[model samples]
Target: MSNTTVKRGEGILSRNRGVLVAFGIIGTWAISLIVLLLIDISQLAIGWRIAATIWQTFLYTGLFITAHDAMHGAIAPSNPKLNQRIGSFALLVYALFDYKKMMRTHWLHHQQPASEVDPDFHNGKFKNFFAWYGYFMFRYWSWVRLFGLMAIYNIISLVLKVPEVNLNWFWVAPAIASSLQLFFFGTYLPHREPEGGYVNENRAQSSNWSVFWSFVTCYHFGYHEEHHEQPNVPWWRLPELHQRKLNAD
Candidate 1:
């Protein structure tokens, strides 16, 4: 392909198709949540109520995926301004940090994995099996930092005697919990290779199913090797790029 053709292909992957797919998925998930909320408010049985709550939590995972795509500039094409807007909206709904700042940090992770600059790394080895188990079991600690940050905002609102400030807690608490759960289950666990498990050059490539599931559940992030190799490729194109790289090999 000529340079112009490659650039056009990049534009299609980054701006047009990628953003539409991401927004469509996110909108569908949001509508599903609204429907569930309507059903829950209708005073369903106790069992159904519990199930609805679980489903709501799953929806929270979808929000994480959407925000993840925004961070990668895959939610609305290659235009940084549009990407930032989409990312900021996602952060408002799901995360408690500055979207642009977080994206910069995440980009560092793509450049170097498990390095000192990679914010995602938790390098300390568990002292024992129980220690490792505790790390996995109590993954909520990841959100403590985020909650603590938001608590500062909450405290300021209270100090100013701002009306309706209390309402923020409704989304704040669950957002923190869900964000922590995503970091633990979708990120930390997958990156860690157990003693007996197979370890590919990129741990994410260990299994085809692992990558597929990660793409579906984590917004195409499981193709870590491909992302690392081609940082400019949008998230929606990572799987195809990975396949091409594999075929080339």
Candidate 2:
């Protein structure tokens, strides 16, 4: 909480930096999706389309990661309303998510991670990857989200004259893939119980991956323990803190 009140410092993300990065991600995601929809995928080679899909998925992941930073007050620490607004926009663009609802659920996750009360927890029964992912989606899924997506898809394909193939490949597929990417790197791998049992109060673990792979995986979210320890650190700074702690050890 102390970190949340501070401005620029060692390992502390400044408000301007957070805002710039947050808007940068949102801007890129919006522009990329729009361009992809407008492009003639039929004219493009299969390899290019595949590359575009992967790139779009990474952007989708960035959208959520940006929103996650806002949840911790890292985006605009002194301006609560601005923080919420940015987070809300990102979540809406991501999946028609309710920002306030997600904020509450995420705080619960931080407070009681891997416990029965934690919304993100799988209660030990869903140890299998697909099973836990199913549980996780079920927990967050709403009829509104389903119908909202349907409505959006219809509007984009019909009124906007975007091709169904473009919507399927560039728009929908990337979002689904991004969810798996986020869950694997940020939640499942970090929070799943180990054979020796939990090691700390955070009830989380971190990857030993280098910084590049950490960012490639999930914006450094694989450093889960560092996150729980300093919840105010933005996604981009986790690697610095992680490396510092690793050096200390």
Candidate 3:
């Protein structure tokens, strides 16, 4: 396919795909969280509640994945202002994260990857899972964010009279679980040192999982190598590029 053909194809697909998907994910996440918080958990069976938690966790991860796409400017290629505004909104909804801070750090992760300079890396000292995860949390956590979330929780609970049980299970638990899901699949699995060492400039590895599992894991972010190579491809289109890479190899 010529560049002209590819660009034309992308133009058709890109018209409103990213904007729609971004809003869809955000809308779903917000609705689900609200419903879960207000629903009568006592009426639901244990298994059903667990399923709801898992579903919400997936949506929370989707929030971050949407923001990640926006960080790459994949969400709106032609409109910088709209692109970043969406990115900022996604990050705020995700966890009150600072989009500018995260965008800068993410570019560093792409630029230096597994090196010490990378903010997402293990910092060379905390190589184990728990330690590294703690380090990762420490790097991004802020008192302001903490207080902001706490205030939100209190306002919903004390002012709105929502049960703390629902808040804990649906809102807080899913957000924390989503972070673990993202880090374990997207960061640790793809970037950890393989026995043979990294084989490319991106200093990343792609998971050999099937496409379904890859998407389930972290929005195809487990295909980290392809992402580093083609950063402009949106999350929904990663599997296509991954398949192309596999066929060439």
Candidate 4:
């Protein structure tokens, strides 16, 4: 397609799709939390609980990615304040991530990817994935906040008659899994050395695989170069942008 065609298509996208999708993801996330709370985990078999927990963990990743889009101003491009508020709340819900702190770190990550300034950078600190992961948590972890979250959940379960197992299966486990997903797929795989890229050293790269696998890997965050170039595109739309680039080439 021609530039005009691309522009027109992007213009249409620039309208309500971002915010609408944001709301939709928010709705799904809210519903998932409610269901997890209401569902009595003790009644289900251990196998079923495990399966359900994994499925819910995937959904939690989606919620976090929606918030990630908002951080990039992909959602509600015309209404930044709205996007900011939504992003903050979305991060808040997903493992109680502090939006402002994340924003600062993320911006730095973009500005100096894989460099010392990038908060996520892990050069010389750890040798392997497990080691790096431990350090990553060390820099950003807040035990006080985590304990408070657990306390609140315990109270909520008492008042609402929700199962503790459900909290473990749905909330706690999923949040932990979500962290691994975000770290492994979104950060580690995309930004690691050699295969992963840096600004001056090696530089991050995108998946050459089909967009399906790319998104499957990490909500199209596997398209790391594309994302770094155009941070404003939502995760759902990264495939389109990648395709458009291919067509232009």
Candidate 5:
């Protein structure tokens, strides 16, 4: 296939079907949490409190999908409105604050997977004896800084009572912490491509399990190579395109 050849046919709804399902599941879970919160308010049950915490974690995972769609410009049905609404909503939930800026940065990530400029790259490795141990333990400090900024944003928003910013202190702290953890363990850590590493003919197999889960939770982001190869294709059809390339290869 020619580099410039565009693969079409992934419609808005088709691409977003997984996201729509995720929304339904999250909505159900949220409603259950609200009921639990109401019960806790009336009679203060420890079990209810525990359940609420678990549900909150699930909600954060759901927000990942929200961020993914917004980044891909797939949420609002059109480009201009899509970015504004989805970006704003994600910022409100994840305390990201600047979706446009994040999107620009994310584009660079896609452009350079394991290169020095890629903020997500895991650079250090151990020799002979402790190679595996060192590889697993080595973490990227840049990602920590990125998430630290997000946490700071959330704290300031809560302190200031910003409109559209949810002021629930109960979840705010944990949300920030979880978002940071997800950014490291869940996203960047698994996506590092080594120098001269084999690029999988099948894009789906190229990424690690964390990225695969990310694709499920965050639209089709795990199909990283395909997305880089063809940014015009919608998120929903990413897997299909990857499969086609694999078959052709």
Candidate 6:
């Protein structure tokens, strides 16, 4: 979307469509969670467990990404209260995130991306992934969330003896992996400064790729500029926005 599009109200999404898309993404995520609950990865071969764990991480991140959309009002544009509720629920489901805390910084990120004030972006401050990731966790880490999840795992696994829960494999492992996926694909790639003399605040990975790959990369979030431009558009519509950008180019 462009300035004209925003002014013309073309960027405002259909609430019905937004609600449906929200539920659809949430449904897919729920299915993956149920599958994890049903299967005892403990009995599976080590290789299978690893593969399942990776898949689970992707699903976990999907929920968080959806919540990000909700933060921008893309998930329920016609209803602010509904959008906030959905965003809160999505973040709560995703690693016990605080919706208001995240929204405060995230909106700031949109306002001043790649700048010193951008809470999420490390810019060039950290020399490497390890340094940057460590800083990210430090800034956003929640000790109450940490203990809460630990308590849940212990209660379910130790107290109840639910082998299928496998809290370490099913919960902790995926959340850990999801942190890497979300940070690298969503924050680092898009917000990094573009090449010299080309002044663009946001970058993308949404070229001639299938929607599957686009979503696979980062819930179609790789189209960072389009996302910021049309904050009202949901992740599912980002590729269409990206395609329009390509055609216009």
TM-score of each: 0.62, 0.94, 0.94, 0.86, 0.54, 0.85
Our model 3 lands, by Cα RMSD against the true structure, at 3.9
Clashing pairs in 1: 14-77, 15-77
Clashing pairs in 6: none
Determine the backbone clash count of candidate 1: 2
Top candidate when judged by lDDT against the true structure:
2
TM-score of 5: 0.54
Which ten contiguous residues of candidate 5 have the minimum total lDDT?
Answer: 161-170
lDDT of 5 at 228: 62
Output the lDDT of residue 124, model 3.
91
Candidate 6 segments whose C-alpha is farther than 4 A from its true place: 1-14, 201-210
lDDT of 4: 0.80
Model 4, 1-249: lDDT tens digits are: 899999999888669798878788788878978886787666889898887788778778888898889888988888899999989888888767888888888888888887677777676667478887777777788897788788889797898778787787788898889788888877777677773334443356667779777766677887777788889888888888778877887
Error of 1 at 146 (Å): 6.6
**Model 4 ranges off by over 4 Å:** 1-14, 195-202, 245-249
Model 3: lDDT of residue 169: 90
Model 1, 1-249: lDDT tens digits are 899999999877654775676576567656755454334243566676555554555556666666677776666654778777766776655545567676777776666555445556553666343454465435324476567666865764567443332223223334545655565555555556567753554444422444567554554556666665665666667778767877898
RMSD in order of candidates: 7.1, 5.0, 3.9, 4.5, 9.2, 6.3
Please write out the lDDT profile of model 3 over residues 71-169, one tens digit for every residue: 999998889899999999989978899999999999999999999998888989878888888998998889999999999999999999999999999
The per-candidate count of clashes, in order, stands at 2, 0, 0, 5, 0, 0
Q: What is the C-alpha lDDT of each candidate?
A: 0.58, 0.93, 0.91, 0.80, 0.52, 0.77
- Model 6 superposed RMSD (Cα): 6.3
Q: lDDT order of candidates, best first?
A: 2, 3, 4, 6, 1, 5
Relative to the true structure, candidate 3 reaches a TM of 0.94
Q: Model 5 shows how many backbone clashes?
A: 0
